[model samples]
Structure formats: C-alpha cells, structure tokens
Target: MNGPKKEIPLCEVCQQPANQICGGCKLVYYCSKAHQKLGWREGHKFKCCAFKVQYSETFGRHMVATRDIKQGEMILKEKPAVMGPRMSGPAHCLSCGKKLEPMKIKEIYDFYKCTSCNWPMCGPECEKADIHKAECKIMTDRKYKCTIKYEQPDKTEAAYCVIAPLRALLMKDSNPQQYENIMALESHLEDRINTPLYVILKANLVTFIIQVLGLPFDEDSILKVASIYDTNAFDVRCLDGSKRLRAIYVTASMMNHNCKPNTRHIYLGDNYNLAVIATVPISKGEMITLTYTQTLLGTLDRSKLLKINKCFECVCERCRDPTEFGTYIGSIYCSICNGPFGNGIEKRPMLISSNPLDETATWKCEKCDHFILSRQMFWGNNALSQELMKIRKDGPEKFEEFIEKYSQTLHPNNHLVLQAKLALLQIYGNYKGYTLSELPDHLLKRKLDLCHELLELADQLEPGWSRFRGTILLDLQAAMVVQTKRDYEAEKITKEGVQDELMESMVLLQEAANILRVEPEMRPTLEAKIEELTRFLQTPE
Candidate 1:
C-alpha cells in the first residue's frame, strides 16, 4: 500500500481539511473565498508580517519579530473583529458609537430611530449601518423596545450594558467564524467569576440576554463572552473623543505586556483599524510587547494594575529593578537622608520595595536601613494621588505648591511630582492669563526646565516615538520658540544665538511631527506647525 495520504492542512476559519492556502503568506489555509475574506479581515493581511506567532509556557501565544524592525515601522494593521459600546456608558448612537445628544421634548418624536427596531441612532445612514443591523433585528424580533430616553444624556445607562454581549452572542449564528475567533481569545473566566464586575455583568447582562432578549445562551457562556471582552478588548476613543467604545483585535491582543513596551499602536479612521508600530529597533526573534498600563506609573502601581486587569504579575526588567532603571519614579526620599531630619546632605537615599512583585513586601531605606510596610507606602501614595487629582484643576499655583511641598518627602523624579509638572507644562503656555506671550521670563525659564526634566524622565521610562514623548516634544518646541524670541527682544541673545535657538526648535518640531505621523487627527495640526516653523526659520533675520 502507498504511504498514508499526506494530511491536508485545515481551514483557519472553519478548521475543515482544505487545499487552498493564502496566496500571499502561503501559511494559512482557507476553505472558501468567503472564509478567505474573513481570515484577511481578521488578521492574515498583516500576519504575512515582520513578526510570527510563537507559543511558550510563560507567554501562551505571542508575536515575535521575524526580522529587524526600525523605529516607526508598521508591524501589523487589522480591523477589529468585533466592536461595541462599553459595559456602562452615556447614551450613544448604536451605529457609530458617538455620544447622542438628548432630544428636546418636541424633537423626540422626530429623532432618528431605526425604522425596524425603534432604537435611537445618529441618523438615516446609521439606521442602516451594518454594525447595528444584526442586533437591531434581534431586538425587533423579540419585541424588546429600547426604553433609554433622551433625558440625562450623560448619565450611565444600565440598558447600554447589554449591547456588546448581545452582539457577541448574535455572532454564534450570524457569523460562526467571527464567533469562533472571539471565543478563542483569553476569557480569564476562572479568575473573573464572582468578582464585583463579574457579579454585576451576570445579574444585569447575562439575565437580560437570556430572559429579556430570549437568546438561548447559558449564564456561563454569556459571562464567558463578557470575560473575553474584559480581558482582551481595547478601549477605543471615538475620532472626535466624545465617546469611548471597546473593540477586540485577535492578533494585536496576543502581544505580551511589558513595563517598557517595544511597540505602540494607534487606531485609524472610522472603522478603527489598528496599526502597531515599533517604537524602537526590534531585533529578530525578540518577543513583541505592548504596555497594558500607563508608562508613567511606578513599578508597584504598574504591577497592581496588570495583576488586576490583565491577570498577570509583570516581573519585567523595569519592575524587577528597585530604582526603576535609576529614575526612582516610584521611590520615596528617605527622611533621614533627604528630609528635614537629615543634615542637609547631598546623598539621595530612597525608600524602595524589597520585593517589587510582592504586594506585602517591606520597603527599606537604602541608607538609613529604616523599613516600612508596603501597605503603608501604598496608602501614602494613594493619599498623595487623591490630593493630586483635587488640585489638578486649580492651575499653576496649586501645581507649584504641590511640587514644593512634596519635593522634600518624595524623590525629585517621583511619579506624582512628574504628573504635577506635566500638568503645569500644558497650563503655563495655554491657559488664559498664562499664555506664552503673557508668561514672564522667570516662568518661561521654569517651563523650559520642566520640559527638559520630563523629557529626560520620558526617555528613561517611555522612550522613543511614543505618544507621550510626541506630546512632550510639542510642548518643548513651543516653549523653546517662545523663550528664544523673548530673549531676542530683551537683547539677552545675539542674532546668531536666535538663529541657533530657532533651529533647535525646528528640529524638535520635526521630531514631534514624525512621531505623530501615524495619528490621523494630529497630522493636520503638525503639518501646519511644521510649515509655519519652516517659513519663520527661512525668513531673513
């Protein structure tokens, strides 16, 4: 007998034995033209990629760079497999996820509603939008009218919770391939069950999908969908920033979390296509990473957030270092070494966690050898953060007071002080009465110093082509330009000195423009700034 017939590869979507392979990658198999389209939209278009998926015991499924990737090089771009409103939110258009304005009493009757489903939508076009069509049919078939009134447009609506889960459930029959892709994502159901959000989802979402909508899904299955969403969905801000929605991208979600991620992603256009780009040069075979938490957060806070939200403790290089790569953004200045209790020495001993990964770890002063409970440190930081939130709206004076008051107790580069300074950076030049032209020479210098300090911290913490760095670069360039002109007017600098400063500001602006190149909303503004700066620099002295 001939050797057993060679086993055929299975379709990626349906898993049926298949002969057709993707012509581009020749790596993935599809059963039909329809499934091919689905596969491409799901991720294969980008998966013929600079990276390849790999599995390990530590990182179950993650992407790895297949070849060297330069800074700002696009790694992957794919449309969201599923997108819908957040768990709870204000009234929003069912079609586009835009916040819906409250309809006045007279206009309520004429307000745009899906002709079939009677659900409020943005307009006639949205009434026929594909995203809303499936769910609208289900609600209409079940005779469930949306009772969400126009009153209290900003108040969080409990009824809005059902839309996303309902959409995911509808996928079971409406689109089996997408349903399979979504269900295959990490759910963390075991970890999520009986948690506060889990309980709320179960009581509100699960019950409604089963009893109210009359969907034939069990509580566990429904909650599993919610768990998948909670674990994997990206919080997408609408183009106008008026509303936030959630979307799941199968390939993008697989990258493991790192404190200092090698990659940055931006959502593009109305369809929310995501483009993941390398923030720094990535070597071949390196595992791809994306930060699930804010880069400005300290090690302890980062660990806490990752543990709670992503279901893992990050022991990355940054988290493992007590000094956080010497930035010491998380550490408190030791009172005996740097505070009033000391002899005013230049020594900068700091209190840092003995075990960064352990929540109950003791914090020991590097010089004084004094130890404090991690809980105590946590409470202290929490209180300070609360105070920071309160004074954030009070403008520059409050921020100055906050920085001065904590400078002795906290490390100079402490995350809280950095946050206060970042706030001041925006307020100093943009706020009324604090505009760049109105800003005094001393305050201008202060702003320049703040930019330098924060940019240095950003380089260490969130380095290279990052949105955070891009924003700071914009602020820095603006401050430099204003200060240079002020110095020129006051005769503090010569014409050549002015030329040198303007040239430096031009470089800063170009860097900012390059960094924000992939951002659609920022492109026009950046382009305008670049043109204006180029003209100024080229003009005669």
Candidate 2:
C-alpha cells in the first residue's frame, strides 16, 4: 500500500501545483521563476518564515521587535489563516464573502450547488478555493445541504455561523499543524459561554455541528471553536468585493489592546494581507497592541464595550484619565456659553466612570460654578443622543434643526454634536440634491468648516494618521479646491491668491494621501486627486 500521499504546496499566485522551490526560504513552493517573482512583488518576501512565532508569559503569543523596529515599518503582513462572513451578518457567499444574490449568483456567475454537496459557490475557481474546499469536502461526504436560507428568523446568519467553525474542524484533518496553531490561540470560552449568544449557540450551533454536520467533537470542544472566533476574529473589511468579511490571523491576533495604540494596520486588497505599521516608535520588547475597541468612542463607552466584548476592563492611561487624556470626547457642552465646561479649571469634573464602574461622577463647571449631577449629565447626553438618532430618518431638515437647537446649550465639539456634524457632512455632498457643484459659496464654506471642526476634534480624539482624519481632510481639500476654482473663474481672486489657495489645499491633500495610500482601495482616488491638485499648482501664479 502507498504511504500517506506527499503534500504539495500550491503556488500563491496562480493557485497551481508548484514544483519549483523558493531559494530564499524553503517554506514556499513556486511553479516557475516568473510566478516566484510575481509572488515576491505581492509581499510573500516578508513572510517571516525564518523568524520564530514566539510566545510571551505576560501578553500570550505576541510578535515582538526582534531588533529595533522603526516607525512606519511594516511589522507584519499576513493573509487570513481563515476568513468568512461575520456572525449576525446578512447572507454572503461562503467562498468570497460577497453578498449572495442566490439567483443572480446562479444566473450570472454560473454559481451552482456543488454536484456532490449542494453548497453554493461562484464557479469551479471558487468551488476549489482553499476557503471552501476542506469544509466543502466534509459537508459533501456527510451529504449536508445548507437547509437554511436568507429568510430564516436568524436572517441568513443561523446557517452561516456553521461555516467558520466547520472550517476549524476540517482544518484539524487537512492541515493539522495550522489547526494546532489556531487551537493554541486563546478561546476565552469560559467568558463567552456565559453570554446570551451562547443560549442561541447551544440551540443552533451545537445541534448543527454535532447533529447536522455529524462532527464527532464533544459539545464543550465545539463551543471552544466559537469562543475562539468571538474573542479573536478581526474584521477583514471589504475584500474580494465582499462587505464586512472577518478573518482570524495566526500572527496578528497575538497583539493585545491599547486605547492610544502605537501601531496601526492597513488592509491590502491585492492579496488579502493586513500590513501593521508603527504609528509611533516601538521600543524593543514592548508588547504590540491593536485597538480591538473603537477609538472614536469616549472613555466610559470604550471601557464598557471592551468589558462586554473582550471580557476585560482596560486600565490604560487613557481609561484611567477621566478626561480621556484631555481629548474630552465624552464631555458635555457648557449649559450656558456652550464652551467646554472646564475650559481652564484644574479640578474640572468630566466622566469619572459609567454604570458598574461608578454609579455617578460630579460634573461641575469650574469656570461658572454650574453644578450638574453625573446622572443629570448623562440624562442630557441621552436626550441629545435620542434627537441625533432621528436625523437618519427625519432627513437633512431635522439634522439642521437638531444642530441649531443643541448648539444653544452644547459645545460644538461635544460627542453628540460631532456625531451630528459627521452625519451632516456625509449628507451635504453624497446625499441627493446636495451635490458639490450645486452647493453655493457660503454652503461650501459651511462644509469646509465642518471638515475643519471634525479634523480638529479628530486630532484631539483619534490622533495620528487615522481613517477619520484622512477622509475628512480629503473632503476639506476637495471642497477648498472647488472653492478656489470658483473664485478664480469669477475673478474673485488674483492668480497669486489662487496659487496660494491651491498650495494650502495641496498640503492637506498630500497629508491625506500619505495617511490613506497604504490602503489599496483608498490609494487610487487619493492619487488622482493629488495629481489634479499638482497640475493646478504648477500653472503660472
């Protein structure tokens, strides 16, 4: 009898049998020098095959600076070890994570249920893709058809949830070593099993994985796979034209959390790799961090989310400081002048803590001696929040009304106001009837002001080269360039004035481009804008 069949690693580029070996490191195989060169250009060269994926006692399995790593350095770039549609999300194709229009997929892409298994896939290419094959083979062997559809009470996710965990189980056999690596990662099963989702998981996932798919694993072990996904899965963003695809990274997941993170990551669409870059200098042996929670939220909100999701209370310097390191993203507007209540006061009260942390905290106006209870402060915030929520349904008229009404008592930089401003900014251009060309000079100025305000607040709250700042800066630059062009055409300014304006706008655009160029999807548009501005700037002043 033949011994166990030798495994052949496929070429990364063309997904073909690769007999030729990579000379740099023997970890990969390539079909030819041409494909090898293509793979290297696409970032296989930085795979860190020689470096050991080390473990730490303090932070668990984390990647460290073996030597001194500099700011803006690509610390890690990795394709997802396993990726699929997110739990509680809409229906999507299992292979590519794109939204599944079942009929459209069937008609246009020739997507069909596998002849053996009856699971959906775009074509033979996607049918045989690594993402689908293992799980597909197992499901087909067991004669499992996805009985669930888009209209179920779970709204497509009930059946979809099984795909990732099933992939985990299948990986145990097809790729045992990789399965071990994933198993070695933290699960936080004990923490997650206590949540409400577990009740549903028990009712659906447990039954399906054991009974429907006919896996031999015990209930506890199966749930462990789910908890691992809950605790560690990172949102992979839009990839392969798929919305909100989440992935598990063997190396990147090793990084811990920090409120004011020193590192930032960009998703490269070319090969589905995430590139982690240093936003600030990282010293040797320092634990690398990624903000698992949204940095845009205020301190109490951030803490609450972290506690609820990740099962830990953060004590980072940002969390410890009641004022959120002086950004005051959580602060209320001064009830009188709408200034930030503690403008210059040393003993200013700003959100000591939220529920479960503290019942209440004082909110005293240091300058004006206006006393508002902690409960009272949040009450006001809640009222503002309720009104802000209506803007989505009530439309632009309501947004302007809400802003004007709140401006009387709330600071422009108040979180609620910022939320409204952000909403309004998005609407002013992209929304129907509010096109940029249709906007008057004063309206353009208003849009410009909103961008500036948001950017200033972003600098204070979400600092460094952030997506929020980059997006707003691009909007600001675009608006300024349009306004400048209008001014020049109407003879409102001299050639020198137009040149000066273009120069100023170019600075902002360049900064926006630099911050955004790392993202593959964001690069082309920003590059085009930068080129347009550069051409305008070169014309005689």
Candidate 3:
C-alpha cells in the first residue's frame, strides 16, 4: 500500500544516494554515494546544513512583506530585554522559584551548585528533573550580551541571573493558555514541522519557553507563554554532557533581513517577546529586518555572521559601500589635519590610496586639504572590530585571548575595551563560581570601573527619560550593593546591623528611584524594598 522509502539516484564512486539537500534546502535527492561525499567535501558542508526551520507565526512582522523591500533594504529595530538582579533587583532560581542563597549573605554564605549543566540551584535534588542546562549554558555566554556572573570560584557558588531564573520559573508551573496556543500552532505546522527550518523554529520556541520560565516544560503548555510573532535566532551554546547544541529562536528569526539596520535586537529574558522599535522610519510593507551579527564590524565581518549562521549572503547598503560608510571614519582620518572627517567632499585634499587593496575604496575628504592614510586609520578603530570578530569565531573559551588582544589594540578605557572586560566579568559572575570575596581585587575593581564607564555612556547616548538608561542604573546599584562592604556582630548587633544595612540599602534604593521616578508602578515596589530593608536593618538589637 505504501510507496518505497524515497531514495535518490546512487552515487558513482560510493554508489550511495545523496544523504543531504542543497540551496534553500528545498530539494533532497542524491545521485550515488561518491557524488554525495564529493558534494560534502567540496563546500556543501558549509551550505544549507545550518539552515533553520521557520513557521508563519514565528516569522512575526516579516511574513507580510508590507512594501517593496529593496534587494538590500534595512528592516526591523530591536533592543535586548532588561534582566537579572542587576535590572530588577536580585533574582531567584527558576526551577525552585527560591531566591538563590546569596554568596555573601551575612550569616550563612550560601551558594548555588549546578550539575554538569549550568542550571543553578542549592543542590542535586533540583537536577532530578530534565533541567534547563541547555539554555543555561547559552545564557552564560557573553555573545548574547547577557553578563550575569558568579562571584565565587567554586562550582557550587554559582547562581542564576534574573533572566535565567525567570525562564526557569516559567517552566515550573502549568499555563493552560500557553499549552493551547502551542498546540494550535503546532497542528498547523505539523505537516511541514519536520522540515529543517520548521524543526529549527519548533526547537527554538520549545527551548526558549522552557529556559525563560525556569521550570519543567511540556509540549502542551507552550502556548500559555507569549508567542514569538517576530524574533531572531542566536547561536545559543548549550551542552548535553560532552556534546553541545545551539539554542535557536523563531520569534527572533522573523526579523526580515538587513545589512545596515537601524535598531538593535536583544533577548528580554522572555523567549517569545523581544523589546523592539524603530531605530529609523519603518515604512509599511517593508520587511522588518534585524542584524543577527554585530554591526560594529565592516562589511566582511557582517557578511560572515549571516553566511555562517543564517546561510545567506548579505549585500546590504553599508556592505556594498566602497568607503564602508562612516564605520571606518576612525580608520580613514584625514592625514593632513590628523583629524576625523565626515564622508563628504570636505576632506578631499588628504586622500591617499597607497595600498592596491583600497584602490576602489575612497580615501580622504575633499574639503580638508589633508592626506588621510588608510593604513593608519585601519589600525586605530577598524582593526579592533576585525580582530574581535576573529576572536569570537574561536568561541567563548577564547574570550580571554580576545580580551588580551583587544586590550593591546584599543584604549584600556575605550568603550570596546570595556565591553570586552564586561564579557569576562559575565563569565566570572554567571557561569563560573568566582565569588565576590574570592575574586581578584583587581578584577572586581575592573568590573566596577567598567560599570561606571557604561553608565556614563548610557546617560550620554540614551534619552534622559529612556527606560533603558533607568534599567542600567538599576544594574549598577545592585552590583554596588553586592560589592559594598558591611560590618556586623551577629550576637551583639543583630538589630543594630540590620538597621545599618537597611539604611545603606535605602540609600541605594533612592539612587534607583531617581532613574525610575517616572515609572510609577516601579516606585511602589522600590519603596517596599526600602521598607523591608529598613525593617531588616532594625532587627531587635
């Protein structure tokens, strides 16, 4: 009754059928085993193999091709979700919903220990369930822009950042709405669900829901969580014992495509929901796009992120620019004036094309009568972006190597340099058990220093009333609280120490309030924290 298991023509050399497909993965037929092997050996290995499955709903706003999207048009605007103890105060374990024991708590310095998986908790009993180790490892990495870290060096000393814990929490309880929604969507996608793209979307959504909730997940409960209407995917790194798998996203996937997009995208802790808006004008019918790769680098690097991960060549406007637009302005400074110049005719006098590689590439400003050396400009800022991209390719373990190299090239206090430092801090704080007390004093100092630098940048670049700036202030305050020193005699000064700590806590809370003063709802909660800290600070001395 059934047809033969579909088999393609055999290969001539090995006489084996094609084991893979090609292009957009729309076709699957192999002629002989040798040809199949030849295809893979040639370049097929790097082709569509990484292609992910996508669903209509998961495609988000991108599904509607609202306007005449030019071949290399820009699309989509995204921001990372605010998360962790830094953003919304201290976070608890996602699995147990128990506030993880703080590493430096006054009496008992408690720490969370995860099994081989990075999922955090107080002990082994928590690991019994199919835990969120997969998502935890991915979140622990710095590439995602998540910088939560453990202050102690012991594996047991590590704990979950708010985002990871929140994801864990979502997993713990049953949500009828989420389940029904997923079921309905899954049914529609079932026929095509087996496709690689579809499979990838399904996997991304599943892992995303489970990880964000921080609880055990069932297929039925998926819909109860938010939907990934418009999202993108990241090369999330997770481990299954010695083997590692990449976490993917469907909501993040549908952010159309672009080379020089206006808005940036980030994970908001919620897998389905991403905080997105127009970095520039978003015309109707235009396929909203987001840059999956870091846009800081020039064309070559941007192309690489998309090529390797999304399996598409990006010929965006910026990428096609002969001058690399204003990105390389720092590298192409006017040699005559030895000053930066805009990409106009002003700096034409100092344009010198020494290297054959930059023959077509424009150099110097026509306005300023000064020669701008391409090589010199390349070394300053452009070089760092290129070098960092190389380092990231080596994976997270090479972070130190990347930082070391970046430090040599960029200013020690440069924003890029600070970013590299923050990456290291994240490893120490979130992934490894490097406690605050045990950390090298210099490292802690460096973390604090960078935090301040970032805060300054946030204040200057972001709008005064921007919610993002407020969130950054919140994170800084929390980090300071953790790093700040406290003295108390448990026996003699129970209530006395409590009062002092509460007072100190209020001081920190007040700073946070200044940032979120306009956010009325947050004010009450912050006030409550201040009150609680006051009460605890005043414990019967």
- Point to the candidate with the largest TM-score: 1
lDDT of each: 0.85, 0.72, 0.43
TM match of model 3 to true structure: 0.33
Q: Write the per-residue lDDT of candidate 2 for residues 430-450, one digit (tens) a residue.
A: 666777887877778889999
Selected candidate, larger TM-score, 2 vs 3:
2
On lDDT, the stronger of 2 and 3 is 2
Between candidates 1 and 2, name the one with more favorable TM-score.
Answer: 1
Residue-level lDDT tens digits of model 1 in 233-288: 89888556886789999889889988999989999988989899888899988998
- List candidate 1 segments past 4 Å from native: 1-47, 107-120, 150-153, 392-394
Q: Which candidate should be chosen as best, given lDDT against the real structure?
A: 1
lDDT rank order? 1, 2, 3
lDDT of 3 by residue, 307-374 (tens): 54454566656555534443231133344443353444443233333332332344445345454444
Error of 3 at 328 (Å): 4.5
Q: Which ten residues in a row have the lowest lDDT in candidate 2?
A: 347-356
